[model samples]
Target: MTGRPNDWLLRQLPYGMLSEDFFVRFVSIFQEQAGTLLQHADNLPYLADVDVTPPAMVRHMGEWLGMPGIDTSYPAATQRRILRTAAQTLQWRGTVRGLTHLLELYSGGPVHVTESGGVYREGAAPDDPAWAVLEVDSTGPLSESDFLALVLDEVPAHVQVEVRVAGRTVWPVLAEEGEMAS
Candidate 1:
């Protein structure tokens, strides 16, 4: 996991742009982890192949990178491990309260962090699976560009929102999800 593109970075290309530092370092990490994933994939072989989903690959890389608690028995635990590793490396935690605050603005929804550190919108309970199962560690390390894409994808449009960062607030052009959901 030291010198190669891990599976997560490869999958994220379809999602949005990445900064040069992020892109380069992540690719290096990904490349370093690919061989380990291949070996481990042959061992337990969760997916049909090593390079399927971004999140899955990240988990695989975490296993090789020695990320703690990454091999949790629960699905949510596994997600959490991947997220935490990515967040720490990317320096995303500073934005947690900010992201939560932004969610409140957009949805007019209350926001709070779960005991495990995942964020939830107003009306979401601590036990809610969205918060419980999401494994929010990576949200901590996200770059401004990546964070914006996350907000656009993660936030529901029916709720009003205004995301603020670095003292600037932004009202995003919400996407249509109703038809898509149906």
Candidate 2:
């Protein structure tokens, strides 16, 4: 049987520092995983009124409300506003941080992160204030296989976590396979 949407979403959580190439792969994987989760969660109730809009200053450049044209209709306007807010809330940084927070909670461990940006360390502490959200830890090295395994094991007993780690994602492992030092 397939895993529940909530369970699947929680398990595909992304964790660890990524190189430039690795980061790109992470983004791709995250989008895929999140898309799947959303698809499975389609039955959930959603507010009818929501819209996204851009600030007037940037209007000259033509802001895309995630569609082809300006949404002037009442429903469209509401959707635009909601979309903008949700977009901001689910920024790349926010999404990554959220995934990290989820990892910590699932692992029942304090995430120690070591990354370039302050965003990675956003709400990380021994006692995370955002318990329900994912936390990013930048302190230590995390292997891709282990990361994938962590996610795979967390899902409810049925669904499989199909993680496709790019060669660049686990460069060290590839290098070792190529007879390079460990």
Candidate 3:
């Protein structure tokens, strides 16, 4: 006589009374359930898929992904973008590209970053002090203090940052018949 298969159903039933067909069916069902559970486990990493995942789950995954600017103050779509691009942004950390990207995100405008005091020479030391000027062309409603704070959070710790809010200036045209007024 054949031995019973190692399964919960087999353990509950008498070994001698079990039929081969019954054991095969039970094993098939167990395999199907295990496959389904494994499939669900495999989908855990894709919890950020907005179509299928809940918003709360996506936010939780964003937290796990350690995305910057993931706070509730930002829109859900913005947070999602940050989480999706977390790896790429981390690769650009401490770089002008990264700072520009961050400033644009926070200020909702174009950003220009310029650095001074790091002039390269043939025999200059690598550890030279540099200052960065961040000129933001902000069309949004962010206040000066808020804009400066946002820039400060993204700039590298070693560089001194000067935040400038730039805007278009229009001067009155001088009349053709008269001299310009001082």
* Strongest candidate by lDDT: 3
Ranking by lDDT: 3, 1, 2
Clashes of 2: 20
lDDT of 2 by residue, 64-122 (tens): 42222222342444435434443453333233353345355333346433322323465
**Candidate 1 lDDT (Cα, 0 to 1):** 0.46
Residue 19 of model 3 has an lDDT of 66
Model 3 earns a TM-score of 0.53
Query: lDDT score, residue 14, model 1?
Result: 49
- Candidate that would win on TM-score: 3
Per-model TM values vs. the true structure? 0.27, 0.21, 0.53
TM-score between model 1 and native: 0.27
